[model samples]
Target: MTETFDLSALKQSLDAAPDHKNLKPLGLQTIYLGRDALTVLPDVVAAMVDATPALGPVAVLSDSTPKRYHAGDLLSFVTGCIDARHRVRNVTVGVAGHTVHADEETLAKAIRDCDGAACLVAVGSGTVSDIGKAVAAAQGIGYIIVQTANSVNGYADDRSVLLINGVKRTIPTRWADVLIVDTDVLVKAPVEMNVSGFADLIATFTAPADWYLATLLGMDDSYSPTVVGLARNQGSALLEAAPLVPQADPNALEQVAKTLTLSGISMGIAGTTAPCSGMEHAVSHLLEMATTKAGNETALHGAQVGVTTIVAALLWQRVLGEIADGGLSRVRVPGPAESQAAVLAAFHTVDPSGAMGAECWRDYERKLARWAHASERIELAKRDWPTHEGTLRHLLATPQSLVAALQSAGAPLRFADLEPSVNEADARWAVANCHLMRERFSIADMANFLGIWDDDLVDELIADAAALGSSR
Candidate 1:
């Protein structure tokens, strides 16, 4: 028997899913946080159709990979779900990427091809949703995300991460006004992918501490822990039910859908990725950019982030421990000149082999140059990290239900398992060079701020990390 999901929140979320809490819509958005909602696609569509004319002429844009996994059937399924009083003028699902191999041009063109799409429905996971959201945002249209898998937490995020010329980039895009998830499909998604999501969700614990650290330094902290707790709790519940998620059982479906929906809403609440990312996310972004360059689709985003989580978690622990030992002085963030020199030097050494194509590196430089001018005054590389490091340790070190869930679902336990090529050197190098990408200070800069950031230090750090690595 399938474990049943607690879907009591669907009614409330549906009635108010469109805008901010203060700008709630009136019965226009609908959500199905239950098992096999996809299989009952007809009902899903019917519920949507009757919800509002605003979504009836919805243009469905998706990457081909998710479409192959039944993303296209969603509109037809929803068409069947609605009452005869509701009418769907037509459901047009325009193919964006091929086999999830989406490109920037394809992503941009998909939105331009919206034709009669009044609102867009994203049918896949991260990649598909990114493309769909960008199109909607550029067109100033509303979007609904129908997640086919629990592979990411950007369902309701206003920003989308994209690959522009094989480089990872974050773009401001429209967030989903409505997030619809069918548990059956998510539980039955590729095992590695689901495990990856498990890792990403758990990283939330570590992420908020980093956010808090920045907030103390004067970054905005309007996001609430209460909203983040919703997703975190749901994620924990799903992890507890990890074994059942991949069984394609109804109970597992509900849990998967609930967690996924909660993740989406958390983005809505935070208005940022504070509820879902941190140094782990930063590391995965680097790996993903490299992977795209190598023509290697090695692992899912969550899987890579999972491996990075432990590394960041350990670094946070050690930094705090050192502070407790009273062996290190509190760090004042380096002056811009000093920090920039360190960042540039680290990137060169890490990229010595030129694994990243020249064109890609050139493009990155151009983008960074453009962004730096406006962001230079922000004092972006924060140095007072040990205190926040202690907080991150509290969040990442504890054995949460997420670790158990990913293990139950057969997710990776360590970096070696995910990237045999990633050695102690690679881990250290990635952390050391982490500064060039984001305008934020994370574990990478924290490691650099500490005196133990040499090759030998990095090696020692990785060795200790590998030794204490947990597959549980």
Candidate 2:
């Protein structure tokens, strides 16, 4: 049996840190992560309901698709436990015979269904949990998340990836008051989903480098070493746990789940997803947007992220090479009008309504303004290129190593390996234009500034990933 995670003890240790005192206090109270963590659901719910007696029944939120528990459906098991002691209201989303999206329409429906609830118990994977957090915030109630799969780290954070005008945007929401990561249920989930969780974590190896680079460029000032260490400190153990995930090893699953929780908390404490989301995530989001617009099934978010990580690592290497070859002295920032045209042209294929492009420009335009006035910052970075490149190199993993980790876990190595495989045209589009989709300063953006991120370099990077067996 694996040792249970002591969240209170962990939080106490974090609170004692000198660097943590100034940050916003984490509101999440308890995390029950172990073999039989699900068994405590009823007692936890009862206690929460007792605390908020002025409210109505406990609303159990889920989707229409059935999930397997030990011997029954997962939702039935959840409502049965909570309903045994308190009044229970069944709140279901995605009732329109499609996948659940954390959009305004779904949030409105959930808010209406879960009206007057004392608390909310989210009973599915990431999308359900995203909707749950948004609903609990909308309804002003306590929230508990029953994590069914070790799918994504979004569950333990205080933000939801909601669709805004057909674009994926991470909106601030409420964290779950209690998180129950039942290893028994996790081990029983689809192997791919659990493996996707393992794949999702590869971001830690490359994203911090992006965050640090953004800080160096003066585009964002939110970089924190303490918050980055919360997740990066567990890097080796995470890779060791990767192979065990496919074997359904409970102990390994527990470790990955714990790291995932830490990753989410890192984001929450830092008040930005930049510490764990960067160029790789931007590429995944663009791919998701294209597939979603085409009315085709999209791959799991983590799976796409896993494959794109290799591409991201390659981009970093390319940028480092350019900087070494004296390309830093020739940095060229684009004009706002030119960037606006490029953004609109790129997003026009996915969203002809121009709303998506307009949204992207609204963010990208800010980045452009920052770049326009950053001549001094760029000059200082040029002088400090040696130190900055060393720092970035230390934070990034080699593409070969990232591929090996995914291969060990039997996770998808290439975009084509993803379910509902992304075709070459779409993959190229996403990797080439990922930087234009968001205001986040990444290695891709740096490469663009250095004039090394054109079509030839994009094709070359994809070919390099293919050589490592991690490209479409």
Candidate 3:
């Protein structure tokens, strides 16, 4: 058996790190990871219930979707464990066949159902965990996450990706007091799900560069190399373990799971998702919004993000090449009205009600305002372009390298390879307008300000990705 990850050591190191001095407290109290980690739930639950005696029953929250545990039903096993010692309220969220979205309606229903709970034990994958966190925050109760898949890193973070006005926004939700990742449970999860986690993690190659670039351009103030290194230092090991993930190798799953947990914590410490979500996540969010509007089944979030990271890497390359050839001299900033119009037009097809566009603009306008006053910062960046470019290069991985890791994991290489398959037209639309969807400044935003981001540029990036066996 692989040795358990030392959560205490990690916390101690982060607390002492200089880069995270003024950050919010890390609310996640403990993590029990490895084989048979689920067996600890009963004791943990009992303790939480005992400590919060004033609070009501323990809410074992989940979706109705059936999941396989070690030769039995996952939800049943979890509830049974907790119900043995404490009162358990099985607050199932969504219907069985339908996918649960962490939107307002679903969250409202879940919060209503989880009222008066002493502690909430979220016993499922990403979406269920997201809802549970939101409910816990709303009710001011303790939250414990029983991660069922080696899925998205959000399980170990204090935020949730929720829909706000039909657009996916990462909202500040409470963190899990305890995170349980059982290798036995993870190995039994669908191989595709595990592979999706691998794909999601590939963003580490490109996202930090985006974050650092934002800091350089004065669009953001938070950029911590120490925080970014938490997961990035494990990139080599992640790449080496990619192929083994598809084979259900327990060691590989555990390695990737630990890396993902660290990644989630990095974002939490950085106080933003910028460390791990960049241009790729914006593009994936647009595609998800499009699919949801069309009443079609959306692909796994990490699967889409993994494929999009390739495009993001290629975009970074293109932007750097342009800057090397003196493209920074022609940097242009559009007026607020012009950008607002573009945002509305881009999102009109997905949401005719214009609610999505308005919500997106509310965030995007902040970025635009920052850019409007960043002439000094932009000039400074231009003067130090060479040095900045060198730093960015180190932060970013080659598109070919990202593609190789995805391919080794038997993960989707192109948008078309995703389950339910995003079409080329939709993919192009998403890539073209990804920068308009969020306030986060990324390479795409830089390209837009440089006047090089257009249909032609997007097409070139797609062709570049095609050269690496990744494109729509």
Candidate models: Cα lDDT each? 0.57, 0.87, 0.88
C-alpha root-mean-square deviation, each candidate: 6.5, 1.8, 1.6
For TM-score, the strongest prediction is 3
Q: Judged by lDDT, which candidate is best?
A: 3
Ten consecutive residues with minimal summed lDDT in candidate 2? Answer: 1-10
Winner by lDDT between candidate 2 and candidate 1? 2
Ranking by TM-score: 3, 2, 1
- The digit string of per-residue lDDT tens for model 1 on 224-283 reads 545555557665577666776556565665665556656656665455665667777877
Model 3 lDDT tens row, 3-89? 365767877887888876756567788888898888888888888878875558889888877888879998889988887887788
The TM-score between candidate 1 and the true structure equals: 0.74
* Number of the candidate with higher lDDT, 1 or 3: 3
Model 1 whole-model lDDT (C-alpha atoms): 0.57
Model 3 scores a TM of 0.97
Please give each candidate's TM-score. 0.74, 0.96, 0.97
Question: What's the CA error at residue 227 for candidate 2, in Å?
Answer: 1.2
Q: In candidate 2, how many Å is residue 95 off?
A: 4.3
By lDDT: ranked, best first: 3, 2, 1
